[model samples]
Target: MKRRIAVLLAGCMVMTALAGCGSTGGEQKETETGSIENKEVTEKSQDTGESSGAEDTISGEITMWTGTWNDGLMDTLLEGFYEKYPDVKVKFEYLPWDGMEDKYLSALQAGAGPDVLDMAIAWTIPYASMGKLQKLDEYIEKNQIDVSDYYEGAVETLYKDGSYYALPYRSETMCLFYNKDLFEAAGLDPESPPATWEELREDAVKLTSEDVYGFGLCGSNAGNTTAQFYSMMFSKGVSLLNEDMTASAFNTQDGVDAFTFWSNLYLKDNVVPKSVLENDNTTNRNLFAEGKLAMFVSGSYDIDPIMEANPDMNMGFALCPGFEGKTSAAQLGGWNLGMSDTCKNPDAAFALMSYLASPEVSVDFSSTFSSCKSAVDNEKYADEKLKVFIEAINYGVPLPGSPYMNQITDILYNEAQAVLSGSKDAETALADAEASVNKALQN
Candidate 1:
């Protein structure tokens, strides 16, 4: 069933054009200053006697690249954009998440990238530094777009050096997803999910069985595992980077303690499985859905798959558990849309971007997929589940926006895997990871 849904989504995505900009049929204009011009042109009149004005005369095609998740959501969003601008055609190319980084880098280097691109928040800094992304401060100001409506963390993720490069379309934050069947089997309350880390530890120990683990972690999924680990650090009042983003502060005692907590779950308590060291986000998610695990940290995207896996599975989701000195913290994950530097129709592209950011269009887009805060706040989309997601965003933190965050995260995963596999202790693994990350930051 999961394979069928993936195939259907893939089929819908294949209908659109995903290639980059083709060669212009006329004399191509290249500007070193990166300034765009607005021009009006008209050929001999046809049947209609009316003349089109400059503002009504958008005539170029814009290509957009995105990762495939929900085809219904993309179609709905493009349908409205196409209706509003008949002259400007949009071509969408869907790329698999696994190879997206390499594909984006190659496209940019070849100067054949799409006009509009959807990328993870973590990639913004690296891409922006390479001049692959167009600065959007002027565009936002010219459009008079209100930034206050977006979740604070979502807005902060796209900024570098005090400039905005992209705008978020959807946001996801981690929550505790529990199986009611498991709770009943373990003589626990199904309705009340754990609200704090202490309660969660107790619940996990009680829920463990020979065939089923109490909890699961995504140690093999580097991006998500690092993100999940960071959320734990935040709950313990530790930050990945200093406020200036120049040095690594993750080696602090609080950071080490957070790592120890997850490691101890498998090492000392014997609640979660040692096999989790080899599992990624998808693997863990599948394990939970199959009723092999009691609880897991997951996002809104897991809803469809979990429901399909067990049609009668009674599952409950709550905000990430809090610690003694801190509130619950979930790391925000999402995609943003940005115009390419080589785009020919900047005006039309800006118009489309601005329209999409409006509350009405945002709500329409969110209805198909999980949307950002502005869309969730819309009365049309307001519901119990969405309200929970929105509240989760209020306590969410953005992933590290440093240009070298990818490298930093790689070190984190390597050490985390060692800790989980019992190849190294938490203190030694975290200390080594922190030093490696700090060295990478210097370069």
Candidate 2:
């Protein structure tokens, strides 16, 4: 499956990119800094002057752009939008994900973008900081929509500065998956997986043989490396950045310990495949399925591919192991919806957004874990294995909302790779990474 907004033009409405980012007739004002200031009235909401401030007044059309992965669900998801505001027209197109972020970046600079954009969780904060996204705090408060209803990790990614830019949409978490047969063969309990980092290492050592490594890790400079590393650091109580996010948090002794542990898994232990430097998530997944690896971490979506690759292989999964005495923490991944600052109909756009985020609709759009808590009641989610991931959501957290996320990912992975390759030790690597990341964040 396929995994993975701009400024507004003046009174002249322009539909250029993503088949036109949702923007229509509305008087526009651009300040000296180029931030759009199209004041939207509160009275134009769907709330009937009660819980939500409303009226049939919420009219006008909004254009939304998202990836084609949700192609068929578009109609089902928009059902709430159509019913809530009969007068408002909803227009959307699913674009390819490969260069979609670059397309949005270009569109924003040219002052032509969508009104409602379905953006990656990582992009929400950057866009909000750029004033490209219309802040939803006012709309959320007025409509009495509760943000607490969503997953905490997904919700964490939408905030920048003091305001949150988007509503949590789809959320997924990675968990530890193991081959039950392999576990039994290694004299380990097939039913009980690793509960802490020490246990994981012990199990990996016992499970490792000339042919099969116990655990798999990724080091390729892709997004998965950052995901895996951050998950490890978080589980061990290490944060990527300090509380204010001003400097590098990984330069500290705690970060050194975590990094050492991660690097040792490959260099010191040699339990992971030698292809780690070139490996990515897909590589590990395939290795695990091929019985070359006994354990790995990934999202629920990998279940199908593994079963398809080796139907007879017995599989078992559990929460990612925590550092000793700590709760399991996962690196949260998801998408969210945000309104463009240039959208003419704030009330209409916000109404549609709130509707889509409601508990009922969230389950429909979410591919893995719905941000809504009540979604567990859905019979499709009754599988016992999924419960492990759902529990993981409790401690999961998102990556920093830095504008330099791409650079940050590269530095994070490259430094770790340096340690793994013996080019640098853990202390030197983390210190160098700390300096580089701080410089990148400043820009």
> Which candidate leads the pack in TM-score?
2
TM-score of 2: 0.86
Top-scoring candidate (lDDT): 2
Q: What number of clashing residue pairs does each candidate have, in the order they appear?
A: 0, 8
- Residue-level lDDT of model 1, residues 8-61, one tens digit each, is 110011101100101111233321112111111122222344444543566577
Please write out the lDDT profile of model 2 over residues 187-287, one tens digit for every residue: 99999999887899999999999999999888874566667767778877787766655677877776788778888999988888998988888888899
Q: Which ten residues in a row have the lowest lDDT in candidate 1?
A: 1-10
Q: Model 2, 369: alpha-carbon shift in Å? A: 1.3
* Predicted structure 1: lDDT: 0.68
Model 2, residue 278: distance off in Å is 1.7
Residue 373 deviation, candidate 1, in Å? Answer: 2.5
